[model samples]
Structure formats: structure tokens, C-alpha cells
Target: MLTVGLLGALVEARRSLELSKPKTQVQWVDLAAPHGPVDLALRLLGDETPAPPSIDPGLVATWDHIPDHGAVDRMLQQALVNAYGFVVGYTDAMHQVCRWIQVLAHPMTQTTNVRALLVGPTGVGKDLVARTVARLGRRASQPFVAINCATLPRELIVAELFGAEAGAYTGLARRRPGLFQAAADGVLFLDEVSELPLELQPVLLRVLDEHAFRPLGSTTQIAFHAQIISATNRELASLIEGGAMRADLYYRLAHVVVPLPSLAERADDLDLLVRYLWRQVDDSDPPEDIIAEVARRAWPGNIRQLRGVIERAVLLRKTVGSTSSLLDEIKAAPAAQPVPSGTLSELRQRFERDVLVSIVQRCGGNIRDIARELGITQRSVYNLLKRHRIAPGK
Candidate 1:
């Protein structure tokens, strides 16, 4: 059972996700009341109250990033550059994302929920771009929940998504709302969607098509009003070809596909990225020569690797002098390597094992908490533990 404190926190979080935007055709109804679930359930049983005032999405668009228009476009561009610390680059890829956001916010498109897919290599800021787009939408002030699909096990995917009721499965002692319901009036970002299991794909498809889903143990269906922004480092076509993904679901989520350029493809942004990363690591301004030197490398790990390099440099500077040459260190470090290709089943199993192991270690082998967080039954958790040779905590 949820502790009184925990339940209060959940209610507070739900309140924080309520929208500031006026009602639209696809606007989410905040069924949660000011009090706890019992009050909310009672209130929901009453006659539906009239929705709040309606606002034109076009008016909301006034704050959006207009790709190629006028003063608004320029301001949006400047804001993005500042927000990203000018590391996103001035490439066409960035422009395309901005353009897609404008189209996504149109009154016609805004009449329905916007489901966007971001495709690119890992560590290329796909999640960052998605969040930026969400920030530009009418639901900017609402919650922005991001889940790494690649990290979730197949058995827990459904539970992590739609939530579960008490007695839904072994280990679930109380009801819990999933990411979809938690992000009701906002954006729910599913990162590395290419890793999603084929079995759960249809469940996601149903929710996307019908905007409704049943909890793990519930008869009543819940409405899903959050905009879904999915990202993947791998090609969906390849996943579909290998029977690892569903084509129908792909088409639905890919309505607005924004492909991010890899770091190698946008070398021009390296200097800005270095400087930005350096400032984050060390509060002081990075030397121009250091930034220039760091920018000349072929960063195979993309921004994620680059950030690590900068962080290491900061440590080295503290230990040695500020003039520490990192070239030798960079050369000694293993190059960014691609994951070896394998059969879909083999790859999925390995991925699941690794993710489960990591989470188990992080959570200190708390089976109940793991089951709750992963949205799986205790039986599934035990199965994973047995498969991976993990000993559950006492």
C-alpha cells in the first residue's frame, strides 16, 4: 500500500502536470482532484464539469519557434542557440526540427495530439531536441516524462507504460499510474524505441489509435492524452524487416519524423560544444586554444563522449596544470565502437540482461521496488533474476 506521504506526493505531482493552455479538441481533462485518490474517484463519479475557456492554438503559436518567418523566428533561433549553448549547430537538421515543430503546432494538427519520432545515432541529442519541441508547444508548462525504451525489459514495458492496479500481479501491493497517465497533459518521450519488444508494440499501437488503455488489472479504461515523442538510434525499417518492430505502429509514430545529424555530420558545431561543455565542467571560461584543439577530433561517441572528455580534462587540470595535453589521453582511450550486430533475439536478450543487471545493482536488489518501477510482476522479476544470476536483496 502507498504510504500517506507517498500518496500525497503522487497527488501533488499530478496537480503539477495540469495544463495552463485552454481546452482544445484533444486537450486532456484533469480528472485528478485537489485532494487524494478517494476524493478524485468520488469527483470523477459526479457529472462532468464544463471545461475551462478555450484558446486558439494559433494564439499559442505566437510563442512557438517559427522556422522562417520574421522577428519571432529570429527570437526563437536566438533562444534555441542560447538554450543549447549554441551546441546544436546552425545545420539544416536543426532547422528541420524547428520547422516540424511549427507544423506540429498548427491549428489543424493541434486539433489532435502530436506524435513525433526522432531518429538519429545515440548521444546525438535526440532527447534534447524532443524536449525543446515540447517546450515550444502549448503544453510547454506541463510535465515532460522521458522513458528509455531500450532500458526496459519486455515483461515490464506494458506496466511501466500504462501502470497497474493493486493485485495486478505478484509484488504489486498498491495501484500505480504509469508514464502515459502521469504525463497526461504533457509530453511522454520514449527514447530508443527501436529496442521496444514486438509483443508490446501492439499495445502501444492500440493506445495511440484509440487514446485509451486498460491498466494491468483494471476493467475500466483510462484516457491517454499525452503527446508521444519517440526516438530511436536504429532504423525502424531494419527493425520491421527483422520482425522486431511493427510497421503499422511505425507509421503512426513517424507522422513527424525528425532526423538528427550525427556529430561527425555536424563537425562545425564541435568548438561550440567544447566551450559549452567546458563551462559546465569548470565554471571558468575554457581557453580558446584548448577548445580549438578539442574540436579537431573525430568524436565517434558524439556529444556524450565529448562531454566525458571535457569532464576528464577538468579533472586533469585540477591535478596537473591547466595546460595538460589531453591528446595522449584521448589517443590511449578506446575509440567509440559500435555495438556488434547479432540476431534480434540474441541482441534483445543481451540488452535485457544488461539493463536488468544495472537496475538491480542500482536499486540494491530490491525486488518489490524493481517490480514497481519496471512495471512487472514479482514473478517476472524473479524470472529475470534467475536468468541473469542475480540474488535478490533480503
Candidate 2:
């Protein structure tokens, strides 16, 4: 079927080829088939080295008070993490996030339509910020609705965001409003915004522009008098440069950009996260030595990894009925692999290769999409394929 289709396309392209490039001789070109994600990753790394750790946006622990991990929204949470990491004289980068909580208190925070963008590493508690805002508002009427763009199906995203009338799509049988309508006078969080399809950007942009959206197949338009909070672990700017996302949509969503520091970067947050996670896992107070032990190792997986370690310790302790090997259990989990040492240029090339491979994986090796996403010419895309030795196509 593919051969027949290609044969037809070749014949159809002949007229243009003859008219435009009558003098240019034609030669058959052999293009390699697209590589799988694993093959691409291996090519990028230039060895059998594993790919970078993927961030899981859905992982969240049960905590109502203040964020113990990446939750740097409130003053109390900051103070809790202040034990070992917070410096008294250090320049406060989080002043904006802290000031936001202070300035936007109660009714205003709940009622206002201010949008925010949270940028940070995975498991940095970006999700908790909206909850914190709602709590600080102290209003139960303001509902909290969240959606992870990475998790949603590409085909159903529009329906998920704007809702749909019954039978709008093949499987959707009943009428339902999307995240915007459901958010109603509350907060609607869009996590992993970069994963959102390019085609949906304009639609979302229209909704933001009008502050209203019509449901799929519905004539009635509803107002979105709610806060739109977007968070992304990936770099949206690069995506914009490559044309994966719209600049207008990014500007609309990022009213106030809050950057959350990674777990390894925040010292005080370790104590806060470990204690909070320990509280959930065990009834007793978290031992200082245990906390210190957790703080010692590298946390590549960030908050998700830290939470898993504590949770695992509890289960392991329960089985043995003794805390003697609790520290052992924590240490038993393997640490993240160390980055290979190299000169600056070499390191940059390595990073570039990794990013290119990631984009390839995301685009499924589509030549045009990869080129557009990289903001480079298609020839450059072919050049990169040759440079990195990455096969094209899915």
C-alpha cells in the first residue's frame, strides 16, 4: 500500500519537477527508516547509556497544611524548609512567590482572574501552588480543577478543555463541559503545557482572548471567570522558537512566572519534605539521623523519588518489625548516575544531542515536525540526522 501510494505521489510530482528543475538531473536517494525511541536514545547517548529520568507529573502526596516538597507557595512551608537550607542573608529568589501569597490574600486571590505560570523541574510541587492559593483564599466555593497536558489524549484534548455535546465525538455520548467551564470562579491548572498539541494552541488562545469558550457542538458560550495556572517542566521558549507553541498563548498564560528550585538545590526543603512524607508514612516523629541520611544522597527524581524512599522505608520497616535497618533501606536504593566529565563544548554537544533525541522521540521522527520544533531548516534537520547519526521517521 505504501509503495503504491509513493508511486502515485512520484508521478504526480513529475510536472512540478520538470517545470521547476528541468535541467537538474534526478537521482534516486535512499533515506533510512525512522528509528524507535530506544534506538534514538542510544544513538544520541552514543552508547548503551540510559536516557534521562522522566518526570511523572501525576505523583502527589496527601498534605493539606503547607507543601513539604516543592510547595513553596506559603510562608509556613518556606519556614518549615528553612531548617537546613534557607540562608538568613541569601538573596531570596522566591520572594515573588512568597509576596504573592501575602499580597493576594483571601477574597481578591479567589475572585481575581490573574493567570500564573510555574516553571521548574519535575516534582517541584508546582501542582500544590494552586491548592495553596485556594486555601489562602479560604473559600470553599472556589473549586480546584487540574489537568496534566502530558497525560491527556491528543485527539480528545479539545473536548477535555472546551467540553463536548453528546455524540460530539465517536465515544463521547453525553454532553459535558470542559475544564474551563468546570473551573468556574476557581483555578484551572494546566500542567506540562509543552506537551499540549500545536493545533490546540490557537483554540486555547481564542478562549483566553475572549475569556469564554463554546462547548464542542454547542452554540452557547460560557465565560471563564477563573484563574488559569500553567506549569511546565519543559522549556516552552524553545518550543516557541521551533513553532510547537504559540507566542501569544505563552504570554497569555505566563502572567507571573514562578520558578521552583529543584530538591537538590533547596537544603531546607529536604527537612520539610522528609518530615512531611514521614508523617504520612509513619505515626512517630521522623528521627533526625534518618532525616540526615535522606539529605545526604543525590535525589535525581526530586520530590517523587524522595517520597518513594520514605514510603518504601515504612513498608520495609513494617516487614522486619525493626527500625535498625531503616537507614539501610533508604541507602539501598541506587543513586543517580554521575554525569560524565568533559570540556564545556563537549558537554554542550552531549546535551544538544540528548535534546535532539528527545525531540525526535516526541515528534516520532517526523522530518518536518522535528525541523519546525527545532526552528531550523529541513536541510539542517537532515544535517542533524547525519551529525547525530539518528534515523528519520517513526
Candidate 3:
């Protein structure tokens, strides 16, 4: 049974997701008033005037003030640096993700059965790049199959990928089609592909070369035409250098390499993401101060870990003092940074200056809030601000 509160929460979560879609798309449509569930739903979203009296106030508040992810993406300037701003930093990574796939999904690239390799740390949404392409590309009507190489049994992996005959392996009873056949003319996502066995690399390479593969115990070969997308958390160069992964296979899979940025790399995006994730997990909007606190903290595990923390915070909010616990965790986690070469004194000064600048900007140049938060006097705040060449207020 859906209570009014539960219904409102679901609306907020959906609205958050919908708002993140490409703003270029026409989102709203004119319709006759409240005759069906669809029309009622639109009224709940505030897309129609005079929402039913049953609508919760919280739901109304959602349309009034919610953090929008698409707006954040659009704010980024797409500088076409070498590697598409990868060398410069993914200040525009989230915004540019769709653009990367649009190129590969384009009809011109589709004929080639374009192979793409996504490289990034775990939980950084490496799979999203491939998934998006699959969902929107020319092959959208076909099946999209994803398999994690790490989870496949070493001995049975070959049979699983290229199909096997009744007598191909021990205990085999009947011939079975593999994922490759199922994903034909579609997309095949090989996740955690670094875990693929070294001996199987040659077989995969052969398939890529010939655009065909012979099933185990089969007399004939099957044509291959799937759009292949491979992903890994490990660096291929190091793997090749370590002789763990074949260099030739790496090149074939990396026809178009895409990199996804981690959460810490998206400092400016924190506010929008927090609102997005918060609404995703719960109906209500997250507190603005919590969003600010999140921006100051480090998220080592990227969005995956940040989402877990946010989900827990929402679940525990009914408990007294839970907000403090959230703040405590943020403050306790040391911000992640690369070590710099400098004298001890110089490094300490740099750290202090950085801290002051962050706080000053977050505080909107309010001297009193800055002093209170830092446990410093107003005089010390001004002195530090001057020394760091920071102007008070954002």
C-alpha cells in the first residue's frame, strides 16, 4: 500500500533522475486533467497546475528546490585537450561522458563494431560509458549482455564465452549457446576484463581479428558482430610490463579508451550529486549544510562509497544526534591529496593556507562563522586571509 508520504518520496526521487537528463529534450507535454494515473502523476510532479489536495507538502517542496545534476554538467566548459581533457583533469568528465559515447554510437562508428576500453578505479561507474552507448546507439533494439570475467570459473570460462558442444567439457549433457551468440548484433560488456586468463587472450585476439569464433567441439565457425566494450580497474601498461596481460590484446580492446573520473576529482559537483543521491535514497532534500560538509570531505572509494554513507545517514536520521555523527565522519576523514615536494615548514604553511581558503570560500567570507568553525579569533582569520591572498566571502 502506498501512503501519501511514500508516494511523495518516490516522486522526488524520480524527479531528481529526470531532471538529470539532457535538457535539450522536451520533457513536458499538454494533457487533459487528472483522468488517469499518468495525469495524476504529472500533477504530483508539479508539471500540471492545482496538484490534488492529497499531495504531500514535501512533494511540493521537491519541485520548489532540488539540486539538478544536468545543470552542473552544462556549467563545465569542454576544452578539447589531448585525451579530451584527461591530462588536464576531468573537471568536465561527467558532462563529456555522453559526448564520448555519441561518437562511438554514431552510425559511422557503428559499422566498424567499435571496440571501447574503459579504464578507471572500481565504483567510478566505468560501466556507465558502455551502458549509455548500448542504450542509445543504433543497436538499442538488440540485447545488451554484461559478464564479469572475475566471476567466471577459470576452466569453464571458454565454454561460457564461445559456447560448447555436448561433449566439449566434463559433465556436459547438451550443447548450449554462449553469451557471444546472445549478444550478436548488440553490445557485449566484459567487466573486470583484467581478470581474464592469460591463455585465453590469444583466443579473444583471434576473434577480434577474424570477427568470428569457433565453439568448442564445433566443426564450423560462427560470425561475430557484437559491439564490444571492455572495462577494468587495473592499468594495462603496468599489466603488460608485468607480463600479466598481453600487449597485443590490450591494443585491440582499446580502439577507443574512455576514462571516468572519481568523486574526489569532482569537487565542484558535490552539491548537485549530494542532492541527486539524497533524493535517490530518500524523498526529502538533504540539508544544505550537509552538502557543504560533504564538499570539504574526502571520498576515497568514489561515488560508490559516498552513496553508502549517504544512504546510511538517511536511514539513521530518525535517531537523535545522527546529523552530528554524519558531520563527525566527514571531519574525521583526512582529505586525499598527492604528496608534494617541499620543506616541512613550507608544506605545513601550504596546508594551512589551503584549509583557510576552503573555509573562507565555504563560509561566503563570513568572518564570524570562519572563526567559530576554525576555533580561531577574528583577528587570526583576517591575518590568515591576508597571508594567503584570499578575499573573505565566496
Candidate 4:
């Protein structure tokens, strides 16, 4: 019995040691630099090696301690990447959306008389910002109703916005609340507001002014007090000039016009957004050159194009294990094989002159640095500058 007791004690001691011993030395690679949340996680896990005894293991007791580990971070990152891509991805998806909150609180946007309009190119996150603001507004608990003016038939536009009474129209069998009535004291986001037909504009204007609309076949009016946010990609000024949009409705809805900038305008934010998205996909550090290549491309579709490019790159990266060749292939593709009318000598002269001028300007008149950057002798750069009729700085 004593021998068995001793054996049991030994087994217990072994189990405790196994439980206490560091399982596997977790080396979290810092994808971002120092002070980055991901880097903080890496530091807590120790510096790419087994954690020292002096380090506190309790620091990472919860996954929330690691910024990249949270589910919200993953979901938000993916959504931002898929929805807006890099560059304007985070800024457009989050920062611009958040601005609506501040705008809602501002005196100009808070007044009952003032309406807000969000204007930008399609897929530039105009509607997304409106929906996000509505979700975060004080009336979050109330219903949020959204109507796409462009999608509604002209005949039903009034009924959709102001409800219909029983037997009011051919198909109206029961009383139904319109979006505006259903969203009372909440929010009504009208997308593509410019598409609202010219004939129905007066009714919309009346609703904006009186905050009340009578259902079809009903003499009594129903009151609706909902915040109205409108969005459009079309140029309202042009539309008004063309007599497509009501000037009065435009004035009322554009009390606070927020123009969202394109992704190309905020290219510097691409790297940060790329890292954020990579982490979301549970990917380690992506090659720096791949990110640089993405930054160089001109995304005409703006954030939407960037996301498609990234999705392709990620898929290629997974299958090929290298993005350099993919980048090279993209670069090597013949650039529209130019019209084929110019002489080689003429093109050469034009190219040389342009390059020399650019290098000189970039050097800020320092010929030495210009020569180094261009990988040529200082005298050669000076000669090219002279040939191009450019004066060198003393």
C-alpha cells in the first residue's frame, strides 16, 4: 500500500510539471512595426524565442489581448478589404463612416430643417456610410428603413414613401405603412436620390417641409419625424441644370454634403490596410514587393478595383508561393503597343529629356545626388541637363 501511494505521488508530480511547462514557444512575428498592436502581441509572446521566466504569462491570458486575434478585427478587416480594398479601404470604410456620427451631432446637421447628402462615385461606400450611421444613431433601437429611389417604379414612388390606405389603389387591399411611416423617429436612407422622378419631386418636397403625408384614399395625414439621409453618385448640379432634379429638394437634402475622396487620393494608407487584411486571412507577412506593386497600380475603380487586385494576388500567392513573378508578368504586359507612328530617335530624345528634367527637379538642384540616383556620372547628368536647356543650381 505504501509503494502504491509513493507511485501515485510521483505520477501527480509529473503531471504538474507537464502542465506548467511552456507548451510550445510561440513566436508571433511582428508584421507591423514597434508600437503596432500585432507587435505588442509578439512582444507578449516573447521575442521569437521561448519566453523568459521574468515575462508575465498572464499578459496573454485572453485572445482579446492580441489585437489581431479578436473576431471583430478579423471580420472588420475582411469586410474592409473586400468592400473597399487598400488605400481608401480603412479610411473610406471606417473613418469616413465615422464622420457621419460627428456630422449628425453638429448644429448644422442636427437641425430639423437641415438634411444631409452623401455624394461620391458608385462603390465608393456612400450607401455603406449611410447604413453604418443609421445603425450607430440614437434611434438604433428603432427600425431603419432604406429605399432606392432608382429602383421604385414611378407609379408606386409616392405610395412607397408615404404608405397606402386600404382599397386606395387597384392592388391596395390593406393599409400598409410606408418606409417613412415605419421609420418614424428613426432613420430613412434614400439612395440614388437624384433618380426620384421629376413629377414626384413636389410630393417629396412637401414631406420634407411638413414632415407629414396622407396615405392614398385617406383624408387624414400621418405625421413622420425621421432623419433623412440621401446619397447620390450623379452630379446634382448638372442634373438640376438638365431639369432632372428639383432644385428645392436638392437644397434641402444637401444641407451637409460629404464628398468621399477616391482610393487613389489616399494611396499611402495601402500598406497599413494590406497588413490588416493579411492578418484577417490568418496569413503571415506578405512579400513587401507585392504590396509595393499593388500601391503602384492606378485603380480606376478606386477601392473596388484595389480589392479585386488584392484578391487575385492573394489567390496567386497561395498557389504559387511567390508574387514577384506575378508582378513581373503584370509589368511586362505590352502597354497597348503604342500607335506605332513615332520614330525611335524622336521617342528616345523625348524620353531622355523628360527623365533628365525629372531627376534634376527631384534632386532639388543637387546634381551629385541626381547622378547617384540615376546611376550615372555627375558629368553625364550635367551634360544631359545642359543638352535639355536646364540650368543647374550652384
lDDT of each: 0.64, 0.62, 0.68, 0.61
TM-score of 1: 0.62
Pairs in steric clash, model 3: 364-393, 365-393
Winner of 3 and 4 under TM-score: 3
- Choose the strongest candidate by TM-score: 3
**How does each model score on TM-score?**
0.62, 0.63, 0.64, 0.57
Where model 3 places Cα greater than 4 Å from the true spot, the runs are: 1-90, 318-321, 338-394
How would you encode candidate 1's per-residue C-alpha lDDT over 1-394 as one tens digit per residue? Answer: 1111212232322232232122211221223322211211101111133323552333333112334333322332233453332344445555555456555544455458767888878888887776765665667778989999878867777788889999888889999898888887888899988778778889889988898998888899998787888989875764564456889999999888887777766665566567667766686766666676665556767888888888888887878876556756655555434445797579667877888887887788888878776656677788778877777762
State how far residue 281 of model 3 sits from its true place (Å).
Answer: 1.9
Q: Pick by lDDT: which candidate is best? A: 3
Candidate 2 matches the true fold with a TM-score of 0.63
> How would you order the candidates by lDDT, starting with the best?
3, 1, 2, 4
Tell me the tens digit of each residue's lDDT in model 4 across 1-394.
1111111232232233234323322222223311111111222231234555655565324323434433433443443333223222334333554444445634344345356798877766676666555554455566778889999978877778788898878977899777888888877889999888889889889978888888777788888777888989876864674467878989988878887765555565567556664554646765688677666665556556556556666777789876776778545533322223567468557777887777777788898898778655677676777777888762
Per-residue CA lDDT of candidate 2, range 1-394, in tens?
A: 1111111222222233324322222222122222100110001111123333441223312223223423322222233233112211111434345445433334554456667788888876777765655544534367788899999988788888889999998877789878888888777888898788888888889888898999988888888787777899876765675567888999998877777766655654566567677766687656787788777677877777778878877776678865657788667755534446897478657887898889999999898998878776677778767887888853
Between 1 and 2, whose lDDT is larger?
Answer: 1
lDDT for residue 227 in candidate 4, whole number 0-100? 82
Over the stretch 228-314, how does candidate 3's per-residue lDDT look in tens digits?
999999767646754668899999998998877777656766776676677666777787778887887778787888788788778
Q: Going through the candidates in order, what is the number of backbone clashes in each? A: 0, 3, 2, 0
RMSD of 4: 18.2
